[model samples]
Target: MELVSKRAFLQMVSPLIQFKRFRGKINIQRPRLPHFEKAKYLAFTKPWFINPKKDKSQVELCKGFGEKLFEKDKENPFQEIIAQELRRWLTTSRLVVFYHHNPMNAEDEFKAYVMFKKQKMHFKKYGKRTLEMAVGGTPYETILDLYVSHNMTVFSPEPEIKKMLNITKKFPQLVLLAGILEGKLVSKNDLVKYSMIPSLQMAQAGLVQTINSVGSQLVSNLNSHQNTLVSHLSERAKQLEEDK
Candidate 1:
């Protein structure tokens, strides 16, 4: 201790001095993680306008919106959350866009929106740009039926969506813009016609009914022939007995 150099003493006590200074006085505040609140607010507040120059297609538009909603980082936590939601909608639901030509008053719009929400459907307005609606499919059931004979799947629009469409028809102001079915973009006319097509379950039931009717008619025809044959045989036997 008597031979201790000033620099050596200071170095040895530096750690202790720093520890004492920090003890019972140190507080840490972690930096807040990035979030999608701003992005989401912008999405909800703004309409999704089509820019022919920038947005070449709906797929491109969706991707761009997704990028803007989340961060560009490959492992961003907020991005993952957004990706999950987008995947769920894209896979499990049918997306449709409608043009709201006649703007509804706040009250009517609220009532209509609430009604749709009660049916497990939600619509978002992109101001005058586009109105998007997502109609979720039934749980644990295939929304479309595949035809093995034709190697094609039938387009069975969800009944809930059809009901909404019917409602919109009555409104006259809300017009169908386009629909995404089985990853294909369809025009409004096609969507409306598709909705009119019988669902898979209904088509199957109709087929079964027709088959049963045909089988029943065939059985009745066979029984009538058997009865006539027996009658003819009985008449011949009676004639033989009388002649004997």
Candidate 2:
């Protein structure tokens, strides 16, 4: 076979978004994929995902999720098979994904636009996670963009990966994950460092804003360590004011 079918090719390779290696505050900014919002608007779809009782077809449509009823079937049955077989190739995989399977082929741009709009609604209702972010602009809609201003490529494609390799080519701090991911010996810190973005994104977003625009807040999210840092800084400011 051609390594992977078009379907298998897309499905087998799980795109890893945040791998945890990017710890510490070295002043990395929020990720801004070029025209990400527009791409999301394009390939996004609101799949009418249903938690079927006996319907394998319905379950498989869910992308390996939902309460399954049939032994021969599973959540998102088609993808389940694809995921299971690809387990060998996707050994270091975190999230198995399919980004280009369009059951509803568009006849024209107008209809395609309509489908895209619906997909966005579905994505919003379902709520995206780090996994979805890892998969680029969601499946069958757009491929992952390898361009990241921050030299992180846990979720980027081959081209971007090359760039990442080139930049970290000489840095010992940046360990080679490609070998370890392929069952070669390597340090755990290397993996952890790559997975660092999700936490940082969560923290920085917390500092700058909330899920619901201004006024509302969610302070409890900060871990004990981060909380102590903020608290200490506040206390120090208060002491300085008193001394003055």
Candidate 3:
């Protein structure tokens, strides 16, 4: 048996130990070859369909991911119902006033409601969508522009233009914009002028008086012609008798 020095033996054994450690430390496996079926399936599968119109970019870009997430439902049933009711009001109400108003606390709003109700008027607040749905494609659509920004509405069955103006005066926060009287859209200035005009009964009475005066004058003129003819005949008869 050949004798080896302790240091030389340790050096030789150390290399083998290091080689075993390296082998254990490093997992030398071949690069995985994907299963043929899986590879084919992956290669043939459709690429994800990204929705360009989607508002967010995330898992939704994957095909069939949350298909219903972006789907739009129909208009709210309540909105439709309210819109129908509004259309009825606009059509049936004799006075529909659109007023621009400042933001009011709940208490003030309640007070306003009570005040309006006292005069047999309705106070309503509607969203633009509701207004659009109600008046869209109708003749009243021309007044749609007046429905913007913090708007409140007053609906009265009577064409109480003057009364409405007076009521609005009590609420300093409310400024009238326009009104629909008897299905006609009247501007603010026109509304003031309309309020100043006489009532329907007064107007009818004046018209009747003028017509009567014209008729009386016509009768007087007609009688004047007949009276002149009679007078001329009487004169001719008198002259003939005198000549005889």
Judged by TM-score, which candidate is best? 3
Q: What count of clashes does model 3 give? A: 0
Taking the tens digit of each residue's C-alpha lDDT, what string does model 1 give over 24-118? 55345764443689768767888676657673777776887787888643554654555445435546565534443465667776766666666
Question: Among all windows of ten consecutive residues in candidate 3, which has the lowest summed lDDT?
Answer: 10-19
Per-residue lDDT of 133-235 in model 3, one digit per residue for the tens?
9989999888779877889999999988888888888788888898998888888999899899999899999999999999999999999999999999999
lDDT of each: 0.55, 0.39, 0.87
**What count of clashes does model 1 give?**
1
Which wins on lDDT, candidate 1 or candidate 2?
1
The residue ranges of model 1 lying beyond 4 angstroms of the native Cα positions read 1-88, 127-161, 232-244
Candidates ranked by TM-score: 3, 1, 2
**Model 2, residue 29: C-alpha shift (Å):** 54
TM-score against native, each model: 0.46, 0.16, 0.55
Q: After superposition, how far is residue 33 of candidate 3 from its true place, in Å?
A: 44
lDDT of 2: 0.39
Cα displacement (angstroms), candidate 3, residue 1, comes to 78
Which sections of candidate 3 miss by over 4 Å?
A: 1-73, 204-244
Task: Show the lowest summed lDDT stretch of 10 residues, model 1.
Answer: 146-155
